[model samples]
Target: MRIELVQLENIRSHVKSTVPFTRGFNCLVGGLGCGKSSVLYAIDFALFGDPLGRSYNYLLREDAETGKVTVQFSQNGKSYTISRGLKRRGKGISQDFDQLKLLEGEKLVASVKSEAVAEQLKAITGLDKDVFREIVWVRQERLKELLDAKPRERQKRLDELFGLSDYEKAWSNLAGYQREYEGEKRAYEKDPDVIGMEKLNMEYNQTAEEFSRLEIELQGIAKKLEEARKTLEEADLKLKELEEIRNLTEELKRKEAQLQVNLTNIEDASAGLAGKIEEKKNLIENFKQRLSTAENRLNPTRLGSRK
Candidate 1:
């Protein structure tokens, strides 16, 4: 896992700051009280919600009302971002206001509360807080703490980092199983039932034969059940297709009704327009007749005028 960015707001001495990291060997160097360590803590808080078991109230700035941390990192070539917020409740008390969001390129894939966020982060980055602090983060003051630790402590840290603890657990489980098996074996050997081993062997062989026959019957039943399931699935698919066809038929009927209404509206409009055209034609004919009558009245012969 590689950190790409760490942002802090109202965390410890930092008001607002962002640090971008490169691919390899990025360092944080600054004077005292400049929030160099706070950046690391902010990264921890953003990923794990709480910073290394510290209280949320102590991590928030004294004068600030809220604190926020956002960290962007890349693991296995996929980018992720985590953001967390702490809001002051009253004097010397603060509560986690924001749930942790695991985002991939602005799309939230998981959101978890503070209690379960650490485990999610561990699963995502393959490192818990202890392994992270031990391997990735080295404080300026306690840089030699890992080296100066006792052998058991150092080995424990190493075991966690290298996953040797799983091996230890496996060994412990194997020893326990061995002890259990030995005890069972000793009990079987010391039992008085071993004296009638021949009779017990005949009974065991008979039971095994019965079990084999039942197993065959069970397999036949399972095969029939699988075939029945397939038939049911086919029937379900056909039902769905039938439902879709019914819906389409209803939609077609609705569209046909709408088409008929549109056709009726068009016929009404056409009839109204034809009526107006006929009225205009009658007015033109009347005007022509009136002009002809006036012409006939104005004729010279009809008025009895000299030539």
Candidate 2:
């Protein structure tokens, strides 16, 4: 987790101070009592709320009724902002629940509760107050004290600070683990399934052989299926060809019927034309015969018009 910025309002010696921090190691080099350490305290408060054994009077400004700290940080590529505020009651200072908020970017993830914000910050940064105090933020005075301490106390303190005591407790808890393991091993050996291993192995082998036989049969069936598919494809092609031939035959039949109708019409037209021509020839012959008769009966020399 990297702290990007810290804003302190009425916190200790700071009054509306905005301190920007870089990614890597940052040093707050200022003269004593310049509120440099107050910034660190405010950041801690913003992230984890109040630390144990620390008084609110040390954090809240002398006469200020309200104090707030906002910390903007980034963890695992995700940015977060957490704010915590303290309000002075009649005799005791309490958390300003209204100003408490944990935000991811612009979205409020937790609000109005110190426990909720602390839990969210712990989940986000993977560090609780204890871890932050002991490992991440070692106090300058405590370091000197640790160096000046006796060997055994120093070692014990170091173990507790580095979380080595948890390992010691875990090792102590494993005292009966070996006995439990032995008992479980004995029970496993006495299991009926373990005693029947040979029979199970023989059955497995027989089943494997049967599976191989079935696999071969499946391959034969697949081959037959492939041949059937090929036959169906060939049948489909022949059916298509037959359909085309049937269409052509039908067209030819229709054309033949049309030609027959045309031939009958031509024959009827020819017979009518022949009849008309014979009638015309007969009329001409009749007219000629009448003319010849008239010529034979009439005189050719003189006329009898006056008599």
Candidate 1 minimal-lDDT segment of 10 residues: 91-100
Task: Write the residue-wise lDDT of candidate 1 on 1-307 in tens digits.
Answer: 8889988888899889888999868878999988887888888777666557667766788889888888999988888898888887766555454545778778876675665666666787888766667677766555687788899998877886788989988999999999999999888887778757857989999999999999999999999999999999999999999999999999999999999999999999999999999999999999989998888878867668754
lDDT for every model? 0.82, 0.87
Prediction 1 TM-score vs. true: 0.50
RMSD for all candidates, in order, please.
Answer: 20.7, 5.8
Model 1 residue pairs with clashes: none
lDDT, model 1, position 111: 73
- Residue 103 C-alpha lDDT in model 1: 84
Model 1 CA deviation exceeding 4 Å by range: 140-143, 160-307
Instruction: Please give me the total number of clashing residue pairs in predicted model 2.
Output: 0
Name the candidate that leads on lDDT: 2
Kindly list the per-residue Cα lDDT of model 2 for residues 1-307, writing each as its tens digit: 8999999999999989999999678888989899998988888788777744599888999899999999999988989988889999988898899999999999999999777777887888888777687668878887688788999998888787677888888887786787798899898789988769857989999999999999999999999999999999999999999999999999999999999999999999999998998998898899899998887666443355434
